[model samples]
Target chain A: MVKHCSVFRDKTELEQGVAKMAELRQRFKKVVLKDRTDYYNTELPSVLELGNMLDIAYSTLIGALAREESRGAHTRTDFPKRNDEKWMQHTLVTKKDDTFSLSYKDVSFTKYEPTERKY
Target chain B: MKIDLKIRRFNPTTKNGREPYYQAYSIEASEGMTVLEALMSIAAAQDPTLSFRRSCRSSICGSCAIKINGFTKLACSTQIIPEHEKAHEMVLEPIANHTVLKDLIVDFDPFWKKLDKVKPYLMPPETQPEGRTKEVHISEKDAEAIDHAQKCIMCGSCNSECNALEIEKKYLGPAALAKAWRFVGDVREEGGRKRLGRLSDDHGIWDCVRCVHCVEYCPKGVEPLTAIERLRSRAIQEGIKDNHGAKHVEAMVNSVKKVGRLDEAAMTFKTLGLLRSLGMIPFGLKMEMHGKMPHPHLFPQIKKIDEVRTIYAEIKRKNKNAKKKPKG
Candidate 1:
């Protein structure tokens, strides 16, 4: 008999996520209120905690970085342009040995291909 | 700009044996006027008998869902300015996968029946302390997961867009499965075993083709595809194996894991097992006749086997790590 583990195990990770979000809110509030934009620049343990809080943030960041286009929710202010050639495939982010890596997955092109992503 | 609103109209009383027809109503473009509002204006001014369902003009209540420009959307929520302009016309019709009642309304009996079959309710444990009431402590992370599940309003949008529903009407579509997962993930619910049993049947959980149309059409961020995947994983965990689907999935996964790619013939043979009397030979022969079965000799030949193995290993590792953490 092939044994499968519980999918409800994600509940635990969700708990850790909430604690991180609360901490980020506080950090963001303090920085904005004190007019200290360099608050994140300061070396602190909270930065690590914030990183842990935004666990899924790496996926979005990597996806944004990989795609030089502002399509859907993926927007890169730095690139300021859409590059369809290099980033036409869907950016898949999977955690490998406690580190997140990016992979490209093929997308089915039916009716529309990637064009200039106008709102 | 004048936009042609092609509305499907069907009056049960006046329209005898005639098929449903699309009546064009040209309306002036108004700022911030939703498709539902434009529909209401057409109904009020041009045709009062233009039948469609609408209660709350807001996205909530899940009513007023219709197909606009080949996509399922809440007419009340969708702004009709630019999207319709790009298309040059708006086609309003009832949600798919259900019987059309009249014009833009569909009979929701099938949707409700599937919802009821899943037994959408919390079945708490019998061992509760008497006279000592305590709030069920849910972490924010778990709460967020539940929050994702909670956003579903039983709108048949997901069902309408579900490819599984198109092929197999008996298969409980995404909305119902997501509801089942909502109950399954509830920490206070002690009926997980029963729930799993109910979903382990042929037309139940095992029937999802994973086409992911439900994931796209859902107005809320509820990914029913993920929920269904989670359910499948849970069902496997609980040792409840349906006839061939479970075995097929397992064989496919194992084949991919072992050889780093799918050995279609080997996977089929593994799934069929050594029992000749199990009626698998005929099935294999049929598939062979249909040219669906690949040759058995070319079993382990695949490009980038190591890369595939590495990807699978990484996914398994992440899943293992994710399970070890506590609920938020």
Candidate 2:
């Protein structure tokens, strides 16, 4: 799954990653039964952890989809330029009710601000 | 590439519950994949019931500590490539000295209890006098001294494999003493003298056996044994040297200086004093009967006794100079 997530090059790849995560999440819920395992506040530890992993994976995919410019370690074959004006702020993704909500938060700039990657 | 991971599995609710056993699963390995990433793969695809504790896969949370091939390490930080390079089969076990709740999950209550002994939090800074408000600032050098100790995430990896804790259950293990050093080294703590006094009490810094297991196993570079030694030195410097542990160390050093070797009788007499040593005569006689006691009368001087004395003298001179130098 992580290998599949890493091969994300464009919007379509990220969407596929999200779909894969959603399928994995559903299978995890069905396979890990609650009756046999120990419960803390009506949730099995394994199921809870799987949910957390799914949340993290889905949010990462959503972040990759929103950031149009190729910046930092993320390389987008479609959008190859660093668009500082539009994609300068940090991308924050929150999943609520099976929906990934995207929001932009201001970057706290110190002395060093974003610049063109010389490499 | 595929590697076989033999994981120790336990489920308390099973028919033959509470009996721990190993179960092997073949998982695909990729470049830059950690042991933790592989475990997650097994958990997701092979068995959703597989359990482990983890947060902050970057290794900051310190929750993913476990034993790989009998060595303590954080699972997330340890790469599977090296283990795969060594052999086709890999072993996974929960860390030693911690009670396992289930597969890969151990109870952290004992670890946290030991940490609570150090008074982990700092005492509140005194309020500004009247209308005079002055900002408190720490120099870069002072902060640097305690910087290494501050990196500890209380992962319990060091405490798990500690040999001293194996023998002395009540001992304030490495992680706690490292935490003590963090507070004691802070310049802002006005009650540092009092804190050192508390640390010198029973089951404190003196209890550490200096096995270096904590130093060897700490996932972070928090050298806990070194921190314990620092705490011991602070105790000695603050004139809080009433305990037998400190006296025993001082006695051993003095005996070595005098006889060019450890004079066990003299060390015992100095550490235990007259009455206690006299009372321990029968015990010493028993040790002699068991052939464990060294012959008291035959104290062999080292071939380089003069060289040893010279080294000691040089160290003392350097320490005296260090004490006399003005503090920045």
Q: What are the candidates' individual DockQ scores?
A: 0.01, 0.18
* Model 1, span B1-328: residue lDDT tens: 6778888866554534147888889888687889998987886567655667777898788988899988899998888987687776799888899888777878999899999999999888787745547767787766675667778987789999988899899999899999998988787777888889889887888888888888898888788988888788788777877556677788888887776667777666666566743567777778889987677566754777778889888998998898797532
lDDT of 2 by residue, A1-119 (tens): 45545633677777787788878877866664533555221236655766788888878877887788788677777788889889888888876777779999888889997678886
Scanning candidate 2 chain A in windows of ten residues, the lowest lDDT window is A34-43
Model 1: how far residue A56 lies from native, Å = 51
DockQ, prediction 2: 0.18
| Tens-digit lDDT track of model 2 for B41-69 | 88767776678888789989999999887
RMSD of each: 25.2, 5.5
CA displacement after TM-score superposition, residue B58 of candidate 1 (Å): 1.9
The best candidate by DockQ is: 2
TM-score of decoy 2: 0.75
Q: What DockQ results for candidate 1?
A: 0.01
